[model samples]
Target: MIWNLGSINADNFYDLPHLPGPGETLTATRFRQGLGGKGANMSVAAARAGARVMHIGATGADGRWAAQRLFEYGVDIPHVAEVDSATGHANIHIDPQGENSIVIFAGANADIDEQMIGAALSEARPGDTLLLQNETSGQVYAAKTAKALGLRLIYAAAPFSAAAVAAILEDIDILVLNAVEAGQLHAATGRELDALPVGDVIVTLGSDGCKWISNTARTTRLFPAFPVVPVDTTGAGDTFTGYLASALDRSLPMPQAITLASRAGALMVTRRGTADVIPDLREVQDHDFG
Candidate 1:
């Protein structure tokens, strides 16, 4: 089972000819709304990849539909509480090149408390996976609880926070971060990539691929990205993280899990949209990487 202490967001996407410059106002050619948030997206991705996923997060009454949507994707959401605050949301501006600039408002996502986290984690057993992101509150508590419970803690260090990462670093079993985030983390810690204290670190390179640094083996391996023409790179990283976690939970080896995750991420960028467009396991399996 995979327990996600994550965020749920109402993603608002605007398609524009080009990203707006500072103080520049431009009209978007199209606008669409969908389910999003790193936590929500990864939960959906894990479910679609055939893992038993439980999403532990909060959403506002107005965002109840977002929680309901997770049901359709096969994510268990008994721990998702409806709070008094507005639903968290993102305003995403996508340019013709498939690059995007985003502004996030953490509303109900910031309302996660220790009580909620404890209640959700109580259902998890030892050896189950606990996944976390920086989008929501209670991460430190979640990390501590998961550690005490003997769960395998996986941290996706996104929207990078030095304090947050430092607080949970000792508790995390596997650490995943994208290239830019890795750079920032390196800057914050004043350590080389391989010298981090974590046992396993995976750094994702957008087009080039991913790098795996195994502290246990004292070795690093590079896994190349599957080639694809990207339409919108919005949720590719989340898709990769979700699939990777699911693969790991199923007892797949690190190399195999990374290969499958690379496929899922490559497939994600071929389409548009966020959580709505994540590829299912069958779609990924049928994809001809050749």
Candidate 2:
């Protein structure tokens, strides 16, 4: 099972012709509400990719709907707790060009405590992949504990935080992030990507491709993404990271796993909405990884 320890939010999205500048108000043509949050998004993506996933996070009193939404995606919500607050919400703007700008209200997500973390880890065991993001502040330590309990830890170091970045250097099986995230870590530690003091790092470069140091074989390689017209790139990174975990869980070799991940990311950009847009294993198999 894949365990996702992060935040869950109810998202409100508006479609504008273009993004507005700071303090500027713009009219939008359409509006929609759905499930969102780093953890929720990645959980749905992984579940859609055919992993049996468990999502652990908090939902607001009124926001408990987030759990229902995640359940619709086949994600287990046994550890999703509801507190005396509104479920966290994201105010998002997606322009005609598919660029997105979002403002988040953490609500119940911000109330997650260490006790919640312990209860969540109680459900995991060795070899199960614990997929974590930066939404929850203290969840990093719980990830380490899961690792100690034999879980293979795969972290997506997004929206980098100082403490989280510092914690990532210890015993992570796979550290996944975008190019900017990769640069941030490299800059912070002043170490070559190859010399980073972790198990392995995968730096995703959007349309350009991805770079990584192989954990098993210890080889550095780069893979270019297959060209496609991207309709919305919102969850491409999540798709890649989730599929990468799924591949590793299935015991695929590194090169084949990267290919699966790259193809999954490429497929995600060809659609809209993070929840329903993720590609399935068959779709990934059909994609040409050229």
Candidate 3:
């Protein structure tokens, strides 16, 4: 089982010819609304990849529909609570090149408390996986609780907060970050990727692929990305992280897990939309990359 203590957001997407500059106003070529948030995206990805995933977070009255969508995607949501605040949301602007810029409102996502974290984690057993991101509150508490409970804790250090990473670093078994985030972490900690104390560290290099460093083995390996022209790169990283965790939970070797995740992420970028667009396990298996 995978327990995701993450955020749920209503994603608003705008297709644009190019990203707008500061103080610039441009009309969108297209607009669409869907479910999003790193947490929600990862949960859906994991579930679709054949893992039993339970999403633990809070949503406002307005966000119930988003939570319902998670259920439709086969993610367990028994611990998602209702809060008084508005649901979190993101405004994503995608340029013709598939590059994106986002503005996020961390509304009810910020309402997660220690009590909620504890309650959700209490349902998890030893050997279960706990996945986290920087979007929601109570992450530090969740890390500590999951560590104490003997769960395999995985942290995706995105939106790259030095302080948040420092706080939870010692507790996480695996740490995943993108190229930009890896640079930020190196700057913050004054150490390179291999020097991080975590057992495993993965640096995702979007089109070039990903690198995996095993701290315990003192070795590094690179996995190249599948070539494709992306339609919208919105949730590609989340898809990778989710699929990686799901593969690991199923007892696949690290190399195999990374390969499967890479395939999933590559497929994700070829499509549009967020959580709804992640590829299923069968689609991944049946894909002919030749």
Candidate 4:
């Protein structure tokens, strides 16, 4: 089982000729909406990847649909709460080149508290997996609680927060980061990425592929990116992390899990949108990585 403490967002997408410049107003060529949020994305991905996922989050009246959407995607959401604040949301502007610019509003996503976290975690047993991201509050409490309960913790350091990562570093078993965030974390801690004390540090290098530094073995391995043309790169990292977590939870070897995750992520970029586009296990299993 995977317990995800994360944000839920309504993703508003606008297709544009190019990203807007400073103070420039441009009309979108197309528009659509869907469920999103780094936390939400990971939970959906893990669920679709065949893990049982429990989502711990909050949504306002207007964002009730987001929670419902998560339920529809196979994530268990009994712990999701209805709060007073509006639901979180993101405005994603995509270009023909598949690049994007985004702005986020954190609403009920910031409403997570210890009560909600404690209650949700009470249902967990030892050795269950806990997934966390920076988009929501109570990460410190969640990390500590999960550790005390003997759950394995996988932390995806995105929208990276130095202080948050620093606060829970000792509790993390695996750390996931993309290239830029890895560099930022390196600068923040004044330590190389390989020097982190976590058992596994996975650095995603975009099209160049990802590298895994294993502290236990004192060795590193590389997994090359599968060949594919991207239409929109959104949610790829979340998909990778979610699938990776699910694979590990199933007792797959680390190298096999990373490779399977690479395939899922490569397929993710080939589609447009956010959580809606995360490929299910069957799709990934049937995909041609060539």
Each candidate's lDDT (Cα)?
A: 0.94, 0.82, 0.94, 0.93
| Comparison by TM-score, 2 against 4, better one | 4
Per-candidate clashes come to 0, 1, 0, 0
Minimum summed lDDT over a 10-residue window in model 4 is located at: 190-199
Candidate 1's clash total is: 0
Per-residue lDDT of 239-274 in model 1, one digit per residue for the tens? Answer: 999999999999999999999999999999999788
CA shift of 208, model 3, Å = 0.9
Off by over 4 Å in 4: 15-30, 93-101
TM-score of each: 0.94, 0.90, 0.93, 0.94
Instruction: For model 2, state the Cα shift of residue 145 in Å.
Output: 1.4
Model 2 C-alpha RMSD vs. true structure (Å) is: 2.3
- The model with the greater TM-score, 2 or 3, is 3
The residue ranges of model 2 lying beyond 4 angstroms of the native Cα positions read 16-29, 94-100, 215-217, 288-290
lDDT of 1: 0.94
Any runs in candidate 3 off by more than 4 Å, and if so which?
A: 14-30, 93-101
lDDT of 4 at 100: 87
Give candidate 4's TM-score.
Answer: 0.94
Q: Write the per-residue lDDT of candidate 2 for residues 88-182, one digit (tens) a residue.
A: 88898999977788898878877777788788888787788888888865566676678788988888888776578786667677888898888
List the candidate numbers ranked by lDDT, top first: 1, 3, 4, 2
